[model samples]
Target: MSPTLLVMLIMMAVPVAMVFVYSTLSNVVMERDPEFVGIENYLTLFGDEIFRKALGQTAIFTVTSVTLHLLIGLGFAMMLNSGLLPRLAAALFRVIYILPWVFTASIVVILWQLLLNPNGVINYLLEAASLIDSKVEWFSNPSLALGTVIFINVWAGYPFIMISLLAGLQGIPGDLYEAAEIDGAGWRARFFNITIPQLFPILLAVAMLDFIWNLQQFPIIWLATGGGPLNATETIATFTYNLAFSKHEFAMASASGVVLFVVSAIVALFYVRHQKARD
Candidate 1:
């Protein structure tokens, strides 16, 4: 316990404390005599147009990704758990659906890059089907880059929710459904009254956790578009990365990182509270 606690403090607490302290100072990591600017960094961040844009885009990305992940995951989970399909077919589909989750972000991004390229299979199919006359630059077009990245994120993320929800769905007693059927409840009614109620706790927990994960997603976006196409897909994670490494504004980046931390912390508090209530 002592060794584990020591490792935790060294690995997590020290870095967090350093970032928080750096967020309050100016010229950190770039200058020997950094000034203590207090909250000036945060003030400047909020006033900066790029930061504001990144903040808003981050919100949109996180919300859209989480919502789609939940919806798609729920749909797939229900299908897999419905027992309508044969066991072998269900197992095969489960493997296919969960395959995306097994790939690393780098691999996922590269795969999408190839598929979404101007002369790629996607555009070729669309062109062949007469869906479009010109090649679509999925990641290079400002209007579509954000949505494209969101789609990639959804593609990669839904499996987590699907697997978890499937487990939760299976744990539900068959007797509950039998009782609902005995009462002459239809599919919608049974799903709404029994399935939803039974799965609400798991849903809440996963949704909040997924929100946090997607809110800080960086690698896929960075690798796919580099938050490019005129900054259309710039998220807080990428913005902070650019600030720290690209621009060498360590203090400002630290402030941005702290902001992200605060937001995630708030969500985490809600998650903890919900778990307490559920328990």
Candidate 2:
């Protein structure tokens, strides 16, 4: 325990502390003797239009990704757990559905890029079916870039929720469902009264975790659009990267990172309190 604690302090705690200190300084990494500017960097960050836009887009991306992840995951979990499908079919579907989650972020982005290209299979099929009269630039079009990345994120993220909910569904007492049926409860009634209630705790926990994950999501969005097409998909993660690496504005970037940290910490605090209550 001592060794593990020391390692964690060195690896995680030290870096976080350094970043926080850097956030209050001016032109760190570039200056030999950076001056302490207190919250000046944060003030500048808040005033920057690009930072504000990235923050808003980050919220949208995180919320939309988590919501879609929950909905799609719940739908698939219910379907797989329903026992309506034959065993072989259910197994096959499980494999297919979980495939996206197994892929690395880079692979997922590359796969989507190919499929979403103007002349790719997706557009080709849409055109052939007359669903689209013209090729749509998914990543290049400002109007659609955010939604496109969100879609890709949802596709890649839903399986974890599905698997978690599926486990929770399986753990639910068969007798409770039987009792509900004996009470003349239809499928909808049983689902609403029994399934949903039973799954609520797991649902909440998974959603919170997914929210944190999506809030920090960088690789997928970076590889997909690099937060481009006129900042349509700009997020906190990308914004921080652009500030620190692209522009070499270390102080501002540290401040932006600290802001992200605060938001995540607040969410995690709620999660911790909820877990304690559950325990």
Off by over 4 Å in 2: none
Q: Judged by lDDT against the true structure, how good is candidate 2?
A: 0.95
lDDT of 2 by residue, 1-279 (tens): 899999988999999999999999999999999999999998899898988999999999999999999999999999999988999999999999999999999999999999999989999999999999999999999999999999999999999999999999999999998998889999999999999999999999999999999999999999999999899999999999999999999989999999999999999998998888889
Q: Model 1, residue 62: what's the lDDT? A: 98
lDDT by residue (101-189, candidate 1, tens digit) is: 99999999999999999999999999999999999999989999999999999999999999999999999999999999999999999
| Model 2: residue 177 alpha-carbon error in angstroms | 1.0
Q: Candidate 2, residue 249: CA error in Å?
A: 1.0
Prediction 1 global C-alpha lDDT = 0.96
TM-score between model 2 and native: 0.98
Distance from true location, Cα of 77 in model 2, Å? 0.5
| Best by the lDDT measure | 1
